[model samples]
Target: MFHRSVLVQKVLEFLLTADDGVYVDATIGDGGHTLAILNAAPKATVIGIDSDKSALETTKERLKFFGKRLELVHGDFENLDDIVLGQLGYGSVDGVLFDLGLRSVMVEDRFRGFSFKKPGPLDMRFNTDETLTAYDVVNRYSPEDLERILREYGDVRGARKIVEKIVDARKKTPITTTEQLAEIVVAGLPQRVHTDVLARVFQAIRIEVNREFEKLERGLYAALEILRPGGRLVVISYHSGEDRIVKHFMATESRDCICPPGLPVCRCGHKRQIKILTKKVVRPSQEEIKQNPRARSARLRAAEKL
Candidate 1:
């Protein structure tokens, strides 16, 4: 089974409004958070979106109880505007939830190659239809491109050395599997380096293959644009990079002016779009983490549209 929803109670409390409304589960994975939302708001309708067909299938089975109340869409959340307008028509959705983390299904399915711990193909695409796979990245990318991805996406240490190893290994034979890539990364780094080095390298490759950061920025802006005034936008991010983007986006949108200091007059004319609800980022409780270790890294932030 996929991992349990992270920070469920908190998500429910912050995401649900007093009256019933439509909500969008931007990264509806296995529908865990979607299920929570539906349960919390009986009259609410949810439009669940995911890039992975397998995930959508599993979500369908799991959320079958909701029937017409839950509508599953096989698409990326980055196209939130198109999906929302196509399905529910224009204007107002009460809330949008973005849970930006790999579900257990992705990591546990060896064929998907999301986890280096499992030996599998070097295909780390969230959507199976994507042409660029980790195999292509590892075997075909130039050393400079490899280094750039490792540095910018994974923030991996010794990125240059890792890329050197990758270049040398592929010259001998194509790197076709997750294990092969992990071994190459490990072999290139000093033995003293933590095992996490391999994970970071894999993360970098996955991020590149999926274009996660680019999609995230687009999706967030779309979500904000689709929300009705006073509607809520909630996001649960698993890493510092993702959290930073969400934080800055919400902060920027919540402010009345983004003009540089000492601008003298209000020439920017930037009106506040949303109000930050959680003054501090909300974290999963120790009890929730103890129950589901994966929730340990979750940081949730919410804002209400103005």
Candidate 2:
């Protein structure tokens, strides 16, 4: 089943600045937020894009009632500029949303190998057509590279020890299953953090397999450029790393200058492009989290083009 959208009410309040407008649901997973947008703004049109064709198909079916108001595309948000240009021809969008969280349907599919609880091939590509997979990350990556991903992507402590265990296990037999990798991770980490570390390790590999951070950075820039003046950009991220990137981008873009404090004159000449709507990152209510536990980690930030 599709999990409920995170911070849907906040999204609508921040995003629906114009009664009739164009919006982009950059990671339109299962169409939860997109559905809400269409319902809230009767005349608004949404360009829903996702790397997963399966997700697009499901959203297309679910949103068919809206007819041409919803256009589902099988593509990554990293190329949002081109996709938006293709649709609008010569203009900008009123709002763009990036909800960087996996859909519940994808995680529940054992064949996709997204969940550690589901024992299946270690293939965690958001787009199955992509060449890289979690299996390659675990079995083929060097200890140093593995350690770097675990440290940077997962915020995993004792990443070297975890990498050592993975390297040792794969040496005997190729680490081929999500269960195998999770078991190794749980064994390598301390008892106190075993559960959390196991999940982070899996997350690190999946992020690497999908090149999530890199794509996210590119997508953010594209989204900002396509937004018209006063247009809103709302992003909901589920991990600290993703949240950090979004926060930094909004903070940097909202400032007029990026020069060092000690500098006498501003050399960067950076102009402020956006104004932050949320003074602080927004989190889901406890009641919402109770209904959908996956919404617990979500952090939402919104900005308007200046």
Candidate 3:
């Protein structure tokens, strides 16, 4: 499972605050990090939440030995406040860990259409029950809409060229699969940047299909409500967009007055709610990256509730 989860040690180091604390693994993919938390803090209880039911099921099996210490919830983290509050009321969470990376299992599953290397239908919904899918975005979006997500979500170079290829290819026949899209992306990009752009295109479409940015924003704000004083909120995000969201959230929440820069006095009366634990963004060490190359892009930020 991609070296059994990236930066598991870092997660435990930053997130576990108490032996019998109630923690929430907001994206408990395969229970890797959650398992690490349980082992590190023997008396801790974890309410693991994920949108993917299959992932929760896999985690359930892997962590069955922990019994009631593991409470696997089936839902999106965007509802984090309601979910956590329902379990422990207000301000009761000891720690919250948002490991915002795709699982290796999900990426490797050809049927999931997450990997450009895999030939599969463009169905990259984390929850199969969700209405939108990668196919909807690729085959149906206008050239402008396609380019918007490519630039806004993917931040890929040559987005216009990629959109042109997609629009033209879809006119011949609908862009139906991951392989087709990857080929179109490659054909549109310069050879030097082709592979990276191809990956970005898929990632952009997947992010759009899942509304990942929207949910992440909502989840970050809502999570602040459930953290007890001194409780930690640790986020590990792999994408730049995801990292930006976490970074801004932490910065905004940690500030006492959010008035305009030139304001003489504080008008926005926003009391600081959190203390930033990591002054700068924390990243995985070279040793960890050597063990799991995917860990290289992980940006971790932590804060404690005030």
User: How good is model 3 by TM-score?
Assistant: 0.95
Task: List candidate 2 stretches off by more than 4 Å.
Answer: 87-90, 188-192
RMSD of 2: 1.4
Cα error, candidate 3, residue 73 (Å): 0.7
- When 1 and 2 are scored with TM-score, the better candidate is 2
Name every residue pair that clashes in candidate 3. Answer: none
RMSD each, Å: 1.5, 1.4, 1.6
Model 1: clashing residue pairs?
none
Tens-digit per-residue lDDT, 1-306, candidate 2: 675789999999999887789999999989999999999999999999999888988898899999999988888899899888875573899999999968888888999998888899999899888999999999998899999999999989889888888998988999899888888888834688867887888899899999999999999999988999999999999989999999999999999999989999999999999999999999999999998888899999999998
Count of backbone collisions in candidate 1:
0
List ranges where model 1 is wrong by over 4 Å: 188-194
lDDT of 2: 0.90
The CA lDDT of each predicted structure is 0.88, 0.90, 0.88
Q: For residues 1-306, write the lDDT of model 1, one tens digit per residue.
A: 676788888888888885579999998998988988888888889999999899899999999989999988999889999889866675679999999967887899999998888999999999999899999989888889999999988888788988898899999999999888888789735676746897788888888999998899899999988988888999999878888999999989989989999988978999989999999999988888898998888999999988
Per TM-score, the best of the predicted structures is 2
Evaluated at residue 40, the lDDT of candidate 2 is 91
Error of 2 at 199 (Å): 0.6
